[model samples]
Target: MYKSTLALAVAVGVLAQQANAAGFVEDSKLSLSSRTMYFDNDNRDVKRDARGRNGDNRESGQGFKLDYISGFTEGVVGFGIDAQALWGIHLDGGKGHHPDNSSFIPSDTDGSAVSQWGRFGANAKARFSKTEAHFGSALAPNLPILVSNDGRLLPQTFEGGTIQSKEIDSLTLNAGQFTHAMGRASSNRTGLSVAGGTQDSNKFQFAGGDWKVSKDLTLQYYYSNLEDFYKQHFLGLVHVLPIADDQSFKTDLRYFDSSSDGKNGEAGYQFSNNGGYAKNTGEIDNKTWSAMFTYTLGGHAFLLGHQQIGDDGGFVWLNQGSVVDDNGRNEGAGGASFYLFTDSMINQFARAGENTTFGQYSYDFARLGVPGLKTSISYLRGDDIRNKSGDGSYNEWERDARIDYVIQEGTFKGLGTSLRHGVYRGSGEAGADMDQTRLIFNYTYSFM
Candidate 1:
């Protein structure tokens, strides 16, 4: 993986340097960050019986990241390059914590720990007025149908080409077709598939646009079709309403409808009744919608949100997965883990048929004394779960609290510290009750 990434990076750099050297400009910037993380999973009985659940082990680790961006030249057509370098050292990840799990890192034949792994990718890009194109291996490109998965330590990157444009004012357009995916680990590129099904298609395509109608309102529409998988459409609206002087409310509404396409075309994948043997008959139609409102007053803010998924299928999207890094979470990998509908205290509250509702209150203590500190508490409850088989009903609840501080001035103005905790409990198909905590300290430095 390392050698391949290096060769690709060099090729991109060489090509960019030679592209119409007369009519272009050369500018470069770099940013780097370091993070340490501690992880622990103590789910006793639930560790074994949980369907599709991976292993749970206690571990701690540290990682470093470097990001670089180069500016294009001036002309009708310009070219540039972007690069990211990642390195991680396992401070404490051992066989006990992850226990037979190869998701975080690749496992050897005898099942033992390796020192560490490094990842890097570069993109060659060209721009023509309001249009631009990028080709390379990199982060999960943001697309509706085949969103990247970020469920583990690092994010998934893909090797492909993408194009975007904004020729019309107040209107933005984007489209990308990917041919290969570099899983979060191994640095190896693999053929793209839908949820690990037998059907394999190397190409994933998407197109979308967003438009702002007024100062405070905007509308969005996009279409995504993954070969042999599913086709999706997304519509979104965002608006802000002034209720008072310093108190205003912002609303974010999003809806998505998806169905199978191509070889896996609509009504393509099917199976017999009576819990017959499952087959790669493909999937059926699925729809999901969510709305959230937030209000701010004085030094405090309040938020409320609700989300629902229609029956007949599970929620789907291009997931980029999650990571344990302190820089923050990346969602472009391929992991499906998410806290409930509440704050960041992800427990499983999005069970079938259940309507999940959440409320949160946040306070900025800096207004009183400190200048870079804040805290928040939130709760989410889901009831009326209809279960996967549409039989029984259940209820679940979660409470989460987070405190974060960032240096407000001087040399450490951007340094951050955070503490997070959560408790979750539920009845019926909501799964087992559990508690988890996370502590993070982060800092970033930019170079230009």
Candidate 2:
């Protein structure tokens, strides 16, 4: 954090010297985004916590994000800066409704939701030729190996330095090193670690590239490692075949290979194997693959996919759920995202030896003369999940549906609203059965 801050300060100083340069202030933009959300989760197989309260969560909150982006200064090597401010306000839900390990909202010392919380972050960037470098605390990477989460009031951010080069005609290269992460709902930053691991690892390095082989085909490969934790490699391929003027078929394939690193199974650095069977408890070892096919015709689209997890263990991703503060309180780093089709609203059907099949259908209302409306429904089912006893397996399923609309014109133009709901049911080592719903409203105002 200190190094990133110092680097940012130096970049700011350099930019200040050229504040009046031609492109510096002329191409700047500012925007303010607002979101209001209501969340409800009903635990069907309710289990009481230490406070004797059922494991149900209901809450409402408002979030605001302010951003400023300045274009690079004119020169052989251009410099720029980006800044962000986020604030979250809790509007409803009492202690009984807020879980001790709530990931959607930050908690107070007394175990209730915090009234309000906020954070500020900035990035300094430089560009030369077709390459760019950014150093900051607001870095959000959406690569094959690492994905920044944004399912809550604010977005999860990382303190890191990243470089991207597009010098090649049809290829892009990316590399980065992240040291810490700021949770979506918390104001503090913490080191990175995997699920069920109480200790933190400060270094996470990744390098990858994407090559557009042709107009309709692309391939990707990436490698990442977290010190004393795990190492992962990813390969992906995407191709789109045009069937007609308004019809197309898309195929997406992804695979991951992962294994343990130094101290991966040691105390405070263990991996939970995602609560499923593990070849060696607390060790990381897995291979997973998925293929998705989509067919689109006019305003209608259909998607189907299948995924399989290796029997050795569940898939692994960067997670900080077990990292707590000195007082043993969760530091709001519980939520994470993986680049997978099973990253559903209610549950991730990713476990050892699990085989999942899923499908979805969506429609755009524009074809029906309602330009700004859309809806989709999806279902996923996974079976043959290995159990710890190593003698049996289990199964689980989830159904998710969502609707969205935006005011296309008028005073509320660009205002969007979305309603999403999910139902999950499982047995054996699967997660608890639950129904969850979220209603959100969003709007953004831009200033140039």
Q: Tally clashing residue pairs in candidate 2.
A: 0
Cα lDDT tens digits, model 1, 1-448, are 4654575677676765665664333466788986666655555336552334445555665667788877776667777877878776666664455544445554444343345766787787888998988878874565434556443345577777788888988888888877667665444456565443433466777788878888888888888766766688888888998878878899988787877666653342221111111123335366668789999997899999998765545544442212212323221223433222332455644434557888899999867998889999998887766554565367778888989999989987898887877777778656567676666667778976
Positional deviation of residue 131's Cα in model 1 after best superposition, in angstroms: 2.3
Task: Give the range where candidate 2 is weakest over 10 consecutive residues by summed lDDT.
Answer: 320-329
- TM for candidate 2 is 0.98
**Over the stretch 1-448, how does candidate 2's per-residue lDDT look in tens digits?**
5667787899899999998998989999999999999989888888787887686789999999999999999999999999999999999985598886788888788888898999999999999999999999988899988889988888999998999999999999999899999999899988899988888898999999999999999999999999999999999999999999999999999999999999999999988888898999899999999999999999999999999999999899997748666667776778899999999998888789999999999999999999999999999999998887663469999999999999999999999999999999999668789999999999999988
Q: What is the lDDT of candidate 1?
A: 0.64
Off by over 4 Å in 1: 1-16, 19-26, 47-54, 102-108, 140-153, 183-186, 194-199, 263-282, 319-345, 348-351
Q: For this target, which candidate reaches the highest lDDT against the unseen true structure?
A: 2
Residue 19 deviation, candidate 2, in Å? 1.2
Q: Report lDDT (CA) for all predictions.
A: 0.64, 0.91
